[model samples]
Target: MNDGPNDTTDLFFRDATDLAHLIRTGQTTSAQVVQAHLDRIAALDPAINAIVTLNEHALDEARAADAALRRARATGGGPGPEIGPLHGVPFTVKDSIDTAGVLTQRGSPIFAGRTPQTDATAVARMKAAGAILLAKTNLPEFSYSTESDNLLSGRTNNPWNLERTPGGSSGGESAAIAAGMSPIGLGTDLAISVRGPAAQTGIVALKPTHGRVPMTGVWPRVPRRDWHVGPMARTVRDLALAYSILEGPDGSDGFATTPRGVDTGVGPAPQRRLRVGWFTDSGLGPVDPQVARTVQRAAEALRGAGVDVEEVTIPALQENNPLALFNAQHVMELKPAMAEATAGHEDEMFTMSTTMLSIPDTSMADYLAAEQGFERIRDGYAEFFSRFDALLLPVLPTFAHEHGAGELTIDGQVVDATHVQTFTVQFNITGMPALSMRFGTSTDGLPIGVQVAGPWHAESTVLHVASVLESLSPVKDQHPDL
Candidate 1:
């Protein structure tokens, strides 16, 4: 791993959309695009440990894409266009999501040699859209922890600071993208996986309305409703592009019942003002002052853009704690699944798997109440969105921290570390679409992200608002030195 500045050319850092355009226009070959990313992975992955498996056929696929594009050009781009919108772009996936013929270890020793016979619906969709799979990223054991570490693949370090975590269970995806090893990738968001890690790594991630992307072939299906498969990338446009491909049911994942909706376009609505509500303290815990300021700044930026941005609190957030509710519900539901997976391989369990097994299960009454509580949270967000088009809030109460952070000090007040999911898990339980993008920097110089969430199936609006914030963000094009 190179501990100093990355010496790779700008090609590795280019967004997936740009790479696709280059390939489409014959400015660059898919082979060169794939080679650039492979080179970056070879140069930087040793220190980051973000990769669990590489798609050995990636270059072959890129070559095939180039040939297809050439054929299309010769045919005058006729009849349905032989290539896809993402033709020739390279992408990655979290190890928890299956990749046909590739290892899908779920970051656990018990499933160390596991390989799926088919790609997850999201992966299949990405491939169908002409993206070459670059690699499979690391995750926490069974994607059960906030830090991406397990007995099988070790830990993933943040590109900003090696000692600090990139945030998980999608940490590997975030780290790989931030370091230019992957232009874009797919991630599974259970509680805070996709969005939180994006915040830490200063990238953009979108957890489209739950079920927008099917969770087919992803692990921990016990709590099927919350396993959201979404895209993470350096730009919001990439998220929009990927989401457009990943949505719609695959005839599996019953929760993915919503039919494909019309694309609302990610541009500003000129006829009406978009209303956005942002808040710093929603009562999850005392947030870091810097994070609070970042949220405020995002709200102000939107206001300056002619958006109706307000600082308000939701009664649902204040009355119901998503962090507590997630733990209460998932712990009981997930333990039995872990038990089955680790049955004979108990000795191979990591702290995450073992600790989960040790926890007492929730009583049936409490479990039922928690289910209702989740519904109430969903209803609250629904009511809030009835008046507002979007919401801007901190993705986490603070910036990235060192690995194994069991506790945190926010604004000089000690708080449970689990509060890290305070802002993120709300959408997880509600199945609302939310995004995490860098809007500010902390005193420690790590990127701080603000969450932009929308009501059910409102991804286009969420992306539009995020794009505006992205363009106006003061912290732009800042990559980690290494």
Candidate 2:
């Protein structure tokens, strides 16, 4: 509502709910809000490279939104047509999500010049809710890597420490939101894409139960059972708000037909004590002590708030490493499409995709074998959740590392850099809803986050627990100096 440059800068940091309230009350025009964000993006994006493609018609859309607001006001607060809950708020979308007439390159050189003629179901839903799309954030090529870098868009730097990575494949979205380039955005999670980057950049993100949100137009679709598209924001409430608008069955995606729905209106802490299970290690790999301690602090805080929190282990989580399963499934499903898209230009593909193409094809027998193991992981979580309302764990074994490092150290143990997904991939295999939220900071002042996973289709419970942690977190309001 404040139009002065200094006030507008602060406004950019406000969550989507606060911005929407200002616009709905007629204290600020959509045009002003959109312009302020555009200015911020223009000023900061060069350092982070978070927004790869800016929407040229954003200001025009804002003017139209202001006109709509005016018309709604003229009607004396009585709705002629329903005004969207997010009317006049600006948001960004990951490049993997299609936006009509916007370039959706998918961070692959093969898709250069690609523009979608229609919005993806998720994007359409947000637009219908009156949210404006301002740009598309970057990602790794075909979203295959945990770091957001590609030959097409270069690398996206972490807002906290430019020398380090903003974890990807959804790294750009996390960076944009954390740097105040966008208050809310969309990100995809297959393994740790959304949660990992959010953890690294000190933001909030959700990997809703697989299929809770339709994946109609996301690219390089593979591991169909594990892929998810979810919301990222500065606050748990904003994440819930976006989820409410983006969720529900779209009729086209069979995975979206679940009867459960998200409750954006999480009014207060439950009157009854909720049982929660907390663990510092998932048996996937060793966790950094700081990361582990952060989870411990979150558990202690929950216990202080009257939630019955205790340490528990899912031994079955150690039975299988899902990296092979994911690689095999992705190679089986995505190779042909990459071959077709690149055609004779195969030599120009991103290094990761190029390496992926060189890997031998996965036989049906091998893929089926992997599926059988995945079923075990899913069953393990089902059993665990049957006894506890939710499970809490660290999002990664360590904080964000120097980009392209071949190895990392966690608690004096050396680990392959690629193993960063060790703690996160199992959830993707199990199709559970997970949230990553800022909880603590590293000695170097980098942010650390913890993951909260709930039963299938239990996004509301996940958000509720995350809200409690957010309230208790020392780093909840922390941001990068940038």
Candidate 3:
């Protein structure tokens, strides 16, 4: 680790809310804040390969924020303490998301020269909250893979260890946030995109209920069956704050029927009595012994608290897993978009798309059946949550796997890498909220995370539980040694 004179890595490690507080208090100018993060990115990004695109215009935005602050200060009436809730906080998002005039290539050569004419709803929301867009992070092609890699941007390596992956498709965003390149970021989770990466990078991420946030300009996976726009940050509060800004219904998403009646700015407060269900294995995949142990420990901690904790099984998960169906739907829906994005580069697109579609296909009838299956699962979750306030599970079967490795081996058993996404994807399918927070580190120093599943539109419950766990372990402000 390069420790320079006046190193700002420590400063950069602050959560987004804390950073915003500093900016609002005039303790740190936005330009200085941007420069500090930029410096950290320059020094550490080489190893993590997290932030693929550095926004050269970020400093300009920072300067504008500073000028705006000065203007507000110059007024005879001093600037109101409440400007934007984000008030000059710096953040990033997956490259797959539209970032105004920036290249939103969806991590493929197909959109090599493509630039979004407008910002994605989440990006616009974040910016409106006074968050500065620092840069666009990398992802898997079309945000398809569980690992971040594309012909346009090589691969995003895990911050905990360079050779391993920072889970994807939001891998870059997680890696960047983990290494302190950016304090917080918005990451879409169709499957394990957000939680997987958060688990690997030791960050806190939330996949709010489906439609909790609009997916206006996000790259689609054909059919777009299970997907979500969520917040990935170094702390649970940061994730909650980011989610508050990003949540809402937009006129754009076709599948978004109605905006769940949840207030983004001020959500429902935490309840007095809490019931939590803890399960390390759901009979889906083999978990790393250490990951399981750490999660169980966290569950025990929660039980020790006033909250009620138990091991309850959701039977629907056993017979009707939507893993295959979800992937099939994603590939089918996005194939055309991917093809169009890679028009000039058909070969690359074909290769990537084929790699994605090669997974077992769930036919139209199969999809219809899967839809019914998902409804059952959703109902099961509803019933489960009626009894339990939250459910706990491992974010991934193991810590960060080797970058772009095809499969994951757990305790002498080889599980398909694609299966690692199974746990997180079900939440998207059920339109429920799920949170991933760093539980502990593996013997190799790689981070392991635990996921908290809450009922539909219950982001507050999920966040409250995560905050409790966060208070117990306190994973925030601990950036990688990068």
TM per candidate comes to 0.96, 0.95, 0.93
lDDT of 3 by residue, 1-482 (tens): 12222435457778888877777777777888899999988888887787877777899988988888888888745556546888777889899889888878788776787888999989998988888899999998888788888888888888778888888889999989888888899999877889989998899899887777888888774446577888998888888788777876778777666564563211335435687898877666688899889889998989887778888678878767768656655555665665565565667763456665455555788667767888888777878877877899988888888755677789779878787887788887777788999978888888889999887767888888888888888444466775
Judged by lDDT relative to the true structure, which candidate is superior, 2 or 3?
Answer: 2
lDDT of 2 by residue, 371-390 (tens): 88888878888798878888
Q: By lDDT, rank the candidates, best first.
A: 1, 2, 3
Return the top candidate by TM-score.
Answer: 1
Q: Write the per-residue lDDT of candidate 1 for residues 183-276, one digit (tens) a residue.
A: 9999989989999999999999999887788888988787887889889999998998998899998898998877887543334564688888
lDDT of each: 0.88, 0.87, 0.80
Task: Compute the lDDT of residue 135 as modeled in candidate 3.
Answer: 91
Please identify which of the two predictions, 1 or 3, would achieve the higher lDDT against the true structure. Answer: 1
Provide the RMSD of all predictions against the true structure, rounded to 1 decimal.
3.3, 2.3, 3.2
Model 3 clashing residue pairs (backbone): 110-341, 110-342, 222-333, 222-334, 223-333
TM-score pick, better of 1 and 3: 1
Q: In candidate 2, list every pair of residues with a backbone clash.
A: none
**Whose lDDT is greatest here?**
1
